[model samples]
Target: MTTITTSAPAIGPLSTSTIAPANPRAPSRKSGIAAASLIRLSGLFAVAAGLVYAGIQPIHPADVLASVTTQSWAVIISLKLAMCLAFLVGIAGIYARQAGRAGWLGLAGFVVFGLSWFLQSGFVFTELFILPPLASIAPQFVDGFLGIVNGHPTELTTGPMAAAYSVVGLLYLVGGILMGVSTVRAGVLPRAPSVLLALAALVTPAAAMLPHALQRFAAVPVGVAFVWLGIALLLELGRSRA
Candidate 1:
C-alpha cells in the first residue's frame, strides 16, 4: 500500500480563473489612444468643413423664395447641412484640445458657439427638407420665412422666425468673439487665425447688409481661420507623437 497526497497545482493548471492574468493598465491605455485618434480625426473634419463653407458661399444664392425650388438652392443648402454637422464635431475637438488653458472665456465661448451650431443645424434641416415641399404647398409662407432670413418685407405672416434668426446671429457673433479672444489669450493656436476669428465676427452685420454677391466674401476670413486652426491642431498632434 502507498500513501498519496494531492494539492492544487502551483500554476493552477489551465483552469478558467487562472488561465491568464488581468492587465489593469491595458484598458486605460487603449482608451487614451482612441481618444487621441478621435481628436486627430476631428482636425481633418475641421479642414474639410472650412473648405466646404468657403466653396459654398461663392455659389450660395439669394434668399428669394424662387431660389428654394431651384437645383442650385438644393445643392447649396445640402452642403450647408453637411458643413454645420462637421463644424459642430470639429469645434468640440478644438475646444477640448485647449480646454485646460482656455479658462472661463473659452468655456463660455465654446458653449455659446456650440449652441449656435445646434440652432443652425435645426434651421438647415428645415431648409433642406421642409422648405422644399412647403415651397410649392405654401409659397407665401416660405417667402415670409426667407424674408426673415434676408431682412426683407413680406406680406405673409411668419411668426417667431425673425426673432429666431436674430437670436442665431447674435449667438454667433458673441461666441466667435469670445472664442477668438480666449484663443489669443491662451496662446495655444496661431495668433493670426485667432485674431481673424474675432474680426470676422465683428464685421458680420456689416457684411450681411451687403448685396448677395458681396455678402459671400464675408465668409472668407472665418473660413481661413478655421482652416488655419485645423492645420495647427494637426501639426501640434504630430509633434506630440514624435
Candidate 2:
C-alpha cells in the first residue's frame, strides 16, 4: 500500500505548424478571381466585335468605286477598323481558353485566322485613310481596286495590291472555315454558334452572288455566331464562378 506518486509525463510544446491553421494557400483565391475576371472581359469584346462586324455588312455599300467616296463609306471603314482590332484581341482569348482541347488543327486555324485579321487591318486602314483620298485623283486605280473586291475584271492593273486583295479574301475564307471547324471539333463552345460560323464562311460566296440588297444578309450568320459565343462564354463563366 505504498504511496505511488507517478509524476505526470512531461508535455512538450505542441509542434509549431509551418502550415497555416486554416489554409496555407488561401491567397491564391484572389489570383484565380482576377484571371476569371480578365477572361470574362474578353468575352465582352468578342460580343462587340461580332456585332459590329456582322451588323455593318447589310449596310455596306456595293463594291462599286462610287461607294468609296460617300460619307457612309467612311463611317463603314471606321467601324471595320474597330471591329478588326477587337477581333484580334477577342479571338486570341477564345483560342487560348480552348487551346489545350483544340489541338494542332485548332492551333493552325488560330494562327492563320489571326494572321488574316492582322493583314485585314492594313486593308481597312488603307480604305479609311489612303483609298478615299485617291478616290478622286486616281479614279482608275480606285475602280480597279473596286473591281478586285467584287471579283470583277478591271480596266487598270492593281499591281501588288490586287494580289494582296485576293490573298486577304482567300485567307479570310480559309481561316474562318478552319477556325469554325476547329471550334466545332473542340467542343468548348455551343455547337449552334460553331456551326453557324462554318456556315457563314460557306455562304459568303453565295452571298456575294446575291443581289446587292441581299449581299449584306450574308453577314447575319457571322454576327449571330459572335453574339451567341459571347453569351455562351459569359454563361460558362457564371456557372464556373457559381
Candidate 3:
C-alpha cells in the first residue's frame, strides 16, 4: 500500500470569487444618514428663522424714520440674521434630500427657493446698512424705499429698486410653491408637513393681501411648516442613528 501518504492537499488562499463582496450600499446608506443628521441640525435654524419672521411686522416707514429705536433695530437685525441663516443651512439639506428623488422639480425648487433667500438677504443688507443711516439723513428717501419694501412701489422708487422688489417677490412666491410641491413628491419627509410647506408657500403671498393685522401673521404657516419639518427630520435622524 502506498505509504498512503495522501497528505491533505494544502488549502490555497480563498479565491477572490469565493470571498463575500462588501455591501455597495453600506457607504451610501451611511452618507444618507449623515446628510439627514445635518439636515436636522439645519432645521433648527429654519424653525427659529420662520418663527422670528412670522412675528415681525415691519414698522411703519414713518415710525422707522421718526425714531429708529434700539429695540426696533435689534428686532429687525435679529430677524434678518435668522432668515439668512435659516435658508442657508436649510436649503443645503433640502437639496441633499430632495435632489436625488424629486428630479427637475427639485432642481427648480432649489434654485428659485435658494435665490429667494439670497435676494432676501440682499434686501436685509440694504435695510441694515443703507436704510438705517439714510433714515437719519434722509427720512423722505427711506419713506419712498419703504413703499417698495411694503410691495407698493411708489414714484419715489427708482427703477432698479422696484425691479429688485419684484424679483424678490417672484422668486419667493414661485420658488416656494415649486419647492413645496417637490418636497411633497420626494416622499422622504412627512406628507402632512410637506403639504403644509406647499400650502404655506402658496398662501404666504396671498396672505399678504389680507388686512394689515393679518399680513404679519402671513408667515406663520410657513413657520409652522418649518417647525414640523424640522421635528420630522430630527425624529428620522434619531431612528437612523439607532
| Best candidate according to lDDT | 1
lDDT of 1: 0.84
lDDT of each: 0.84, 0.79, 0.72
Q: Taking the tens digit of each residue's C-alpha lDDT, what string does model 2 give over 25-131?
A: 76798877887777677788889889997788767877677888899999888999998888877777677767888898888877877788889899788778877
lDDT of 1 by residue, 95-188 (tens): 8788889999999988998788889888888888888899888988888877777677476645577777788989989998998899998888
Candidate 3 accuracy as TM-score? 0.79
Q: Estimate each model's TM-score.
A: 0.86, 0.81, 0.79
User: Which candidate order results from sorting by TM-score in descending order?
Assistant: 1, 2, 3
Would you give me the overall lDDT of model 2? 0.79
Candidate 1 vs candidate 2: which has greater lDDT? 1
Q: Which is better, 1 or 2, measured by TM-score?
A: 1
State which candidate, 1 or 3, has the greater TM-score.
1
Candidate 2 residues lying further than 4 Å off, grouped into runs, are 1-31, 153-159, 211-213
lDDT of 3 by residue, 108-216 (tens): 9888988888878876777767777787677778777766765555677769988987788788788878878888898887788677777777776677777655576
| Model 3, runs deviating above 4 Å | 1-34, 57-64, 67-69
